[model samples]
Target: MCGVDQLRVGLVGGGPWARNVHGPGLAAHPATEITAVWTRRPEVAGELAAEFGGRACDRLDDLLDDVDVVAFAVPPQVQGPLAVRAAAAGRHLICEKPLAGSVEDARAVVTAVQRAGVHSSMVLTLRHSPAVREWLAGLPSAPAGPDTVASARWLSGALLGGPYSASSWRIEHGALLDLSPHVIDLLEAAVGPVASVGWAHHDEPDLWRYGLVHEGGARSTVTMSMRLPIDPTETEFAVFGPGTPHRLAGRTADASTCYAALLDELVAAVAGTGPTPALGVERGLRLQELIEQVRATAG
Candidate 1:
């Protein structure tokens, strides 16, 4: 039985990410308990709930009714409307990136959360990694100006053959929707808010290259793809300024570790013991807007 102080979490997916990260993270966190689980596939949900010592819910509403918060590990399109419903029901939210498939849907989610006065947090996983925190901490704090510029590249063979390759939404949308949120969010945090998409390009096999102009005149270039022939994904972020360049390379931490950190902060915010997380639904909406701009520019 969960303690009175533990936040009851309803997990809303049955896929690998949910099974591997969300279930394990919530069950392990002292401040949270996986009280209910729901997914399109009831059998899979049952399996997950059984593994985590939670009950599988046959309907979304049943899950919502049984828990204080909703943790989503589903695709962005599936997540948006459901998130709005969860917010309307007065449950706090832990949302996935991109928020929704389109800017309109993402905005709807933001509006719903605002209207309901519910606390929400985005699953910007990299932002929670200790190495990423240290990297951002070492960068210049002042708003970046013309003298500062940054670059990022995330190349992976994920779509070539893997569990994620089976994800229809990821295959359709490619790296821009699946990966740019993490990169853009990190760059924006390291420098300043992105003011405009200077240019954008996409090619066959999921390659994306884009330029962004940040507020205060700083600029950034990004290159991403999920069909590359690389073994381990190649990721690097660097800022070149007045002094020596600062760089963050390779993986920071496993997904579960970062997610646990996210849960720690989110549970605190929901309990009124901590400030609202900076990476919330509003931030997700902003990132979605930027992604749309990139797509439009590419066309």
Candidate 2:
């Protein structure tokens, strides 16, 4: 229900994910105008800004002068205070996934957004396929409960060969915190609040797995990594729903598909114009907290 003319937003972070997905998707939306981008790389931001007709601001402070929203595309470590900075300026948020590497930071983000009475959504919903969305939509309108799943896989391999440079933060940060949150949020969305299993541990240097109990009393296993062979259906979806089996194939890493859809949803949510996919800030924070726990266990 968003009108053609609504909010004027800005984006921070000049990374590939922001350039390829968040920045571009915001540009193409009816409700958002990426009016400024805060990135250190002035040249690149300038080019993208020119193409999108938004301004290029060197400092984050410059963005506050004109925008109604701030989309933080930086890494988890940098997102905490920046989120508060934006909220303090009275801007809504659309930060990227893995909001922060720890639960505390995520909670800080949640508090800032809540206190401001402003909407905030993370980008981990990036990998949610339309089939995944549709499947989740069909869940019976029963009271929230913990989900009991026999098994599940959180798969991705795009960073296998390394992205852009040989030094991949995706690998350095391990799997759980960086990549698995996408699936965690997806599962949490399907079920409900995912609670911790005490101080967890990371299973491998490259892999992160955790024990989670959803509100529905379902045991959930969250897995993630930067290592795997690329497959067309790598981001595929499958689920056992209350006694029936359903699988969705062909979830390619089409950057624009699901990422774009979620952007539209966020836009609508900000504009108070349409139904949102019921995103919970705690879900992301829990994933971050689990990541911290697993990492500490490995050390």
Clashes of each: 0, 8
lDDT of 2 by residue, 24-67 (tens): 77878766778888777888779778877588998888987778
Write model 1 residue lDDT over 1-299, tens digit each, in one string. Answer: 24878988999998888888888889999989999999999999999999986799999999999988999999999999999999999999999887997899999999999999988989999999999999888888846999999999999999999889999999999999999999999999988999999999999889999999999789999999999999899999999998789999998867988998898888888888998888999999999999999999999
**Which segments of candidate 1 are over 4 A away from where they belong?**
none
- The prediction achieving the highest lDDT against the true structure is 1
Mind sharing the TM-score for model 1? 0.98
TM-score of each: 0.98, 0.83
Model 2 backbone overlap count = 8
Q: Which ten residues in a row have the lowest lDDT in candidate 1?
A: 1-10
How much is the lDDT of residue 179 in candidate 2? 63
